[model samples]
Target chain A: MMDILSRLNNYTTIVVALGAAVLGMISGVIGSYSVIRKQSLIGDGVSHSALPGVVLAFMMTGNKSTEVLLLGALVAGILAAGFIIGIVKNSRIKFDSALALVMSVFFGTGLVLLSIVQKTPDSAQAGLSRFIFGQVSAILKRDVYIMTIVSAVLILLVILFWKEFKLFSFDPEYAHTLGFKPMRLNLLLMLMTVFTIIIGLQTVGVILMSAMLIAPGVAARQWTDRLWLMIVLSAVFGAGAGVIGAFSSSLAEKLPTGPAIVVVISIIVLISILIAPNRGLISKALRRRKSKKGWLEKGVKGGDII
Target chain B: MNPQLEIQLIAIFIATACALPGVFLVLRKMTMMSDSISHTTLLGIVLAFFIVHDLSSPFLVVGAAAMGVITVWLTESLHKTKLVSEDSSIGIVFPLLFSIAVILISKYAGSVHLDSDSVLEGDLVSAPFYRLELFGVSIGAKYIYISLFYLILNIVLIAVFFKELKVSAFDPMLASVLGFSPILLHYGLMSLVSITAVGAFEAVGSILVIAFMAGPPVTAYLLTDDLKKMLFISGGMGALNAVLGFQLARFFDVSISGAMAVMTGVTFLIVFIFAPQRGLISIALRRKRQKLSFGMLNLLIHLLSHENSEYETREAEHCSLANHLHWHEGYARKIVDKLIIEKLIVVENGILKLTDTGRTYTSNEYSKIFNN
Candidate 1:
């Protein structure tokens, strides 16, 4: 523990952990909305599709600035979302099919562009491929600041539209009847999912980023029925996982930070599923057993009286 | 066989192999399952590697295929809990397994020949070098044989269980009542998906394996309604995508697998837009034509109803048609001109008249519409 704490005193470790924590917190909050709304896999689609944007940003600017690259990722992610929506809306294809098709195709395009970037003889391209698996240890102090600000704005938007989002998520038809446009709210929520995914692309990378988006919400859901509490608990879980994952990966050698974060969040989800109050597997089983015992005792007494 | 030819053959076989199970996946609305299974299979390969200490062992495929089924089973279990949605369940399970695989690879197997990058981004260009040798005789690439084995396995299984798969996919309850085990069929199909993913991932990568599995089947789905025709069309689409993707990569000197995925997407888009019956363009054109004909029908019906009525001058005039029909002037004029071109309606002294053909069409359509 002391060794881990001492390592956190390192400047690079602190920056990476901070960035990851902020990313985890916002993704958790937004991810709860997505999970409840049954749009969990959109995160997966958006993250994979963001790769092309990252590569394109690098190619156009010839630099690896986090802001510019992420901007590119945001554009590509939205465009991919558009493709998914368009496909599902216009054709007989279902949502999952469109997502899988769009996600793979976009990632493939990114890979092609990445190959092109590699042959350009630019030394900056060396760091570009890291976006695939992500190396959070390479995140600069500046990147963390940007991530924090963007995440703050996202959280603010969530707060401002909390009641509307809750309504739309739980009962979209009812929300529509109540004068809220479900389509507009859904689009807003999807944009949040896309932005949260874009911000986390550098921290958890594209492939495993979906876990970060999904696991916390799932874990928090096991502990609470209220939407606000679920959101808060999810954010806490996400931040905890991010910090621990970043710290542990930093402490060890050869452990990639993105996978480390995913592993940590997944563990949280597992434990939450097994033991959280009310809805957990063990708790539910225990309650069932108690009810059965109570019923048996009452039945025996009634038989004696008869 | 030549190296380039071997590569193309491997791609074609892999594409077809993926498409076989892919048809069911698309039909079952479980296309994302392939995406999840493809990622989780890495853990199987890694665990199998640790046991055999060999990268080329057949156990890897078995282990990967098992892991794929486990992924489906786990996701279903989580969904059964009712705490999380099905998509969330899949989103959670696969990444956990894949993360463990990645962590294991980086921590213990870092020194080994295994790496996640090569698994996610397969090198089809070097596939020809993994040649198969049998009893001092050399054959084509080893991948060609592996993929061919999988292709044949898929074809045979799908052929033998066509009825069961079709029934279960369309309606699980009906299939179960008919004495076919839904559990067995579901797992059997999942197992096929896993094995196909493993077989194809060597050349196309795990991610693009989804493209090979989903893209062609979906495109074929837009073109046909029959199950057998869909399967055949999907297979043909897979083969066509492989050839086109190869040529594209050759022209651009890019990654063949990536190029293949792009081609798969491009082909799907083209088919999505231009399919004869179901394409977006055809659907829109059909809608437009229907709108025009409906307008002409309305015009004819109106003129016939008021031919000698007192309101004929009031309602059937060319200028008054817009008010009666609630159409914008431009749209009214456009359809009116279309009717004139088709000899459906004639304008005489500011009054509208229906030709004999137009009158017959209107009466027939009116009866057809009312009967329906």
Candidate 2:
């Protein structure tokens, strides 16, 4: 363990691990609101929509800076969110249909742009495809610093507006009555969500970023009922998964880091759903068995109630 | 057959196959579940390949079908806990399974022929090269046959159990009372989706499969209210999209599946805006028409109620309508002109009065508005 720690003390592993951990925590913190609002799939929609932004940014700038690409992704993701809201409000289409439409169209357009870039006689476009399935080892130390700053700002904002967000997530109408502008708050949350998704695009890719948003919140929900506690727990779980996944992927040869992190978080969620005290499957099953045994001992037949 | 024609045929067949089950998914508000199932089936294909050591093994189909059911089951189970929502469960489950498959593929890229690119965006241009041979005879593309088989199976299933499916989709309680298990039918339909999804996975990637599955059904949904018509229209729309999307790809010299998915969205967009009854334009038009008629009726009722009042009589001129109703003068004039054209009102010596026809209409409108 000491030798492994010393080996991982190198600059690259530490930076990658820290970057993944920050991404995981930010995703968890922002994802809690979306999950509680029952808009979890919007993360999926936003992440997929960011693909075109990345490509367009590269095309326009003729450079592969992470900041430029992420800014482009932010613009595209916000537009996609607006498009979804417009469709849902202006037409008879439901939320899911709007989500599916924006996701597929944006991703498809991204593919078209990517193919165009690939067909061009420029070798610089080689690494652009790696955004689909992210290569964490390729992340430089500067990218880690950007991730750290973004995540710190996100966490600080979440802490600052905790009450308003809680009300917005739990009861928007009541929040409106209390003089809070739910729509503006919603837009803010969505903007933050888009930012979180864009920053993680270099690490988790578009396809699997939704998992990072969902799994941590899901796993933490099993352990608590309070909103604040759930958020804290979710961040911890997400960070733990990130560290473990990064470590294991580094130890194993040819194991991609993003999926490894996602798989780790998923295992955490699976265990939480199965073994958590009151909400878990096993505990519920055990309680049912106890009730059945109690009924039998009291001379009550199974069909008596029916 | 020409390779282009063969590709179009495969595209159409795949679209039609997906659309059959897709109608049910759209109606039941489970279109996102199909997305989850398609992604999770990647793990199924990987596991099946590892076990059977062949990409063409029938067990891959079985394994993928089973995985689809498992995907639905896990999502439903998580949903049943009341801890996570239905969409969250889906968001959680499929990515986990899909990521595992992706990790496995990357870890063992040497031994396995599967790549993430093919899994996400399939090579329809090369689909024709993988031909199926049967008994020393050359068949068409293997995916074409596979899609055809599933399409027929889906048609037969829907035909035989139309009533059950209809009942379960619209009202599962009624289905249960009528001795039809909605759960059983749900799993059965999910299995068919799984099978169809796997068949199309190699021809069109998982993303396009989702577009093909949901797009045509939703487009048809905007055009019709009848389920039977919805199914038929969606199938036709799917076929049409396939051909048009192929032409579009050729025109642009871009990725075929990406072009196909875009065309699917384009088709839906056209229907969304232009469908006769349920479209955005129509709905807006209907609302505008209702507002105009409602304004005219209100004017007639106001005249009828205040015919003998001295103050109303003093303000009963054609120009007074703008003040009486607080509307713009042009809008008031337009409404007055339309009412006069309908012979519901008349202006005599600058005092407006409801005609005999207008009096009866106002009373009827009054009763309709208040009595209901």
Candidate 3:
């Protein structure tokens, strides 16, 4: 056990990685408000939009500091959010396409900027590529602090706004009549999303960030509609994926840590999506079967079973 | 442009062409099924690859399309068991089928020559380069051509079946009333969706297929009210993004899929912000202008209604513009002033009166309050 601890210390990187995963779950759980608001793809949109911010931050700072780049990423992500809302509210395009639209445009710009980064030669630039695919092993002790602080703030905000998020998610029109501005709530939701995606960027990269933001929340959603519980459960699922994926990648000398972590998250999502006891596809079927059996005894035969 | 970009053009065109059917898919809220078809088709592809010992065989497309249909059928079967939701039926069928295919891939990893990676993310770069020359033009990027064939097939089918698809999408009950079998349209759309997906798989991969299928049509929908225009505009948007996506990919040196996704996003943003009729900026401006006018009119009415002010007095002040006027004030004031000049309001010094013409606006309380 001591040896395992020591070896684990050698990759304190995985702990940071796990922290990001936990951040992901918390964001996802909180993000479910947006998701159920039927704005599920916002995470994907914002994550893609954050790319150019990262690259621009790298260019401006002459460094690849996650904190600096993340700030830039947040700005880009928020702008993308504002733009998406603007499109949906003011124009005729639907929410889904608007999200995809922002995602592609911002990500395209990021790719172009990334190419420019690749062309430049410098020591900091050497590690700049890490943001593209997210090599967890490249994590610094400082990254842990940023991730922890941001995640804690996020969790606290979600806790405080739990009822608001819920009321807003289920029925914004109702909330609006009760003096809550659905637009403000939606903006807050998208802004928090910006922060989460930026924090998770160093661990998951842009393209796969949606997988992190959505997969866990989606998995947790299968378990319960109670927002707080869903969040906590998603955090656990995300953290578990992180720790396990980070460890397994370490086990394989050749496997890259980022992809490994993603695969783990994906696996968890797959399980929860398919077979989680309550929320899983299998469980839903089993629950339906049992209910049908109960109904048969009650003289209620065949229908939607809903 | 590199060979990759050119290949991607073929990929994007085929993708855009195929995505024409996707507009219907997303609108009907069955996107997950499209995703499932993507995964389950892997089983079919692998099945064909093993049977024919050829990755490029045409049989692979047929087998894969069949598997896509089978997935839907199996899901429908699970749904009929009186025991599961449609989502669960989907969730249960695909992974099990996919895992079985994965197991087979591992079992024959050496001789299979078809890995899960290729099946999921079909090496678009190399696959597109596989070609057979024709008469003299050397025109054999067969995957693109095959996808084009499917694309045309889809377009023709959609063109012939426009009313049916529209009726069903708007209201299946209405469609059924009109003697159109929604089930047939549903399956037809699903089948076309499957064929397009399978055809585009070798060129652009599944994720891009989804992006194209959902992205541009949605963009077009934002910009237009007409569905026919939506189909045209969405396909155009997809194709435009493909070209831009290719150039953007080359500019950035990233995955074509990533670039195309970004291009779709950019196009959406532009349309969102500036699409003359449906853009945010325009709508906001229009609303701002309308609100200002409404607020000014409210204030004018309040002032004129005070104690002894006549409507003509208010009209003179409005025309003079001495006070801070709201944006909508002009519109309301003009209408009110026109009423007063025409003898609707009899002004007595600094007083206003509401004649029959002026009183007309207040009659409908519901419409007045709602501003509907």
Candidate 4:
């Protein structure tokens, strides 16, 4: 029992999980747009890209403040986004192909940089590779404060841009006709995504941050069609998962919390996917089976659309 | 004795296997699903490792592949339900499986050797250590042999059913009537994707493996439109990127995975901006030239107009020759310049004259317009 308490008391683990909750909220909010835009994989792309930023930040400032590291993450994340956009706009590359191309290249650069960092003699900071796979157990209080501030800022920005984002998302041509610039709006949205993603690096790390960003939104979407509600629910669900995962991992020793919280959020998302109200798999299958039976029982009417 | 040379072969081998079937994946628009499959296979790996009790066991890889296929199956099956979309279905299913895998690793295997770090970092440093021995003579790394077998399997499958696969990818509904089972081809491709994904796990980790599967083929598709060109270009791009990327990664002393991804992006960008007709610079220049030529036509129209015609005026009323306004100042000048270019117009005292050749050309066009 004492072992459990001691493990739980490791402030890093709790801080890490709490930080994940904050990141999860921000990711959940942004991920809704990503999913609706059919860019669920962009999360995966940006997550891997964040690695170079972390390493570069460490190399320059030697102060791994969540701020400096986040700056690195923001720069790299935005560049990756620009690369994807460039591929789509400038090349004949299909959207999926462009996303894939950008994802791999950014991830490759991060990996190469990590290898060099690891080889730098007498540098303990080179061990940031562990951060790549997500060892959130080392998250400190300052990290949590930063994450919280970032999350708050993200939520505030979303509120401010809610109307603009909605118009830009579903009807870019219409938005243009109404004098709203799609490019400018999209740039802002992508920037917000960068800030949120950068803050998320400490908890989910470079590899799985996108997963965290996208999963909760996916789950919450299953439960609602309303965009506002979806974002709110996703944030709540993501935070809940973080709390649960951290609490559980705290029961054991050596269980890295980043992966742990991600796992929990994933499970929550799965539950929603499997059985959420109108969008759940079981409900749909059941509806399909019922409809098939109904059609078999009743003669097909010429006017019946159902 | 040269590490670089030995690694280059390894890079070539991986890229060949990756690009071979990646051609089909890009065509199928299933690259995203393949990526999800790679991630969800983590559950398969963890569960397999747990069951088989060893990470190095062949069963671990096999288990992971099986899980990958299962993910594809589950995602596809669930996607057909009206409740959600394909992307959402994938988003929901695999992350949960992967998360469960992570939870399991934390609970049961926290003290065990396997962890997320090992999974994501991959066993690249140690991959060369695992050799495949044939009749007491080591052939190569076991992964090399395994991946080669998978590669050959993919090649044979592609060869045997090229026509069917092409038809299905281009138009599944039509392919269905032609007695080609698109579902069968789909499953086959998904299985191949899974095999490539799980097999490369040790060499480059799951994310890089997915990158190899999707990135190069995607880049190739951009440069070529023909199916055959796509296949060739995709494979060529993959092989080229892998070799250069691996070396760059090694040289930069960074993780191999990150460097490999960056090189893929850079290559695609270079092709995008400078490649012949489709490249950015060329396309922009072509547009500029088109606009300039168009502007010159407008200038000619203004020049040939009647002195009082004011047709170039932004808010001018219709011409008195409106019925014949098809030959307005803009049209007259356009006609004259076009005639001159066609060797039909001549200048006498700064006044335009239509040569016989110009008259004939104008007659045909005027007749067509009048008739219309």
Name the best candidate (by DockQ).
1
Residue A211 accuracy (lDDT) in model 4:
69
lDDT of 1 by residue, A56-120 (tens): 99889887877788888999999999899889889889999999999999988888888788888
| lDDT (10s digit) by residue, model 3, range B148-184 | 6777897899899998999899899999999999888
Question: In model 2, which regions exceed 4 Å deviation?
Answer: A156-161, A176-183, A275-278, A282-306, B56-58, B109-111, B134-139, B313-324, B328-330, B346-351
Candidate 4 stretches greater than 4 Å from native: A1-18, A206-208, A251-256, A263-267, A270-306, B1-4, B121-144, B246-260, B297-372
Candidate 2 C-alpha lDDT tens digits along B271-330? 888989988899899998998998898788888888878776666777676987789888
The ten-residue window of minimal lDDT in model 4 chain A covers: A126-135
In the range A134-237, model 4's lDDT, one tens digit per residue, is: 55666677778888887788778888989988878777899999999888988888777777766666556654576676778878888998999998998898
Model 1 residue A299 distance off true place after TM-score fit, in angstroms: 5.3
What ranking of all candidate models by TM-score puts the best one first? 1, 2, 4, 3
DockQ of each: 0.72, 0.59, 0.19, 0.46
- Cand. 4 Cα-lDDT: 0.72
**DockQ score for candidate 4:** 0.46
Clashing pairs in 2: none
Instruction: Report how far residue B213 has shifted in candidate 3, in Å.
Output: 3.2
1 against 2, candidate with superior DockQ = 1
lDDT of 2 by residue, A66-181 (tens): 77878878898999999888777776667886787678777777777887788889798887756655766667778778888999998888988999999999999999999999
> lDDT per residue, candidate 4, B1-372, as tens digits?
244555566666676678868777777777777678778788888888888787668888788888988998888876776545666667666766776787788778877787656666565655566677889997766655665676677678778888988898889999999998888888877887788777776677776776788877776776778888877787788778877777776675666655666677778777777877788889999997775555444333433343235542321223322224344466445544655686755665454445676556556655664688
Better of 1 and 3 by DockQ: 1
Between candidates 2 and 4, name the one with more favorable DockQ.
2
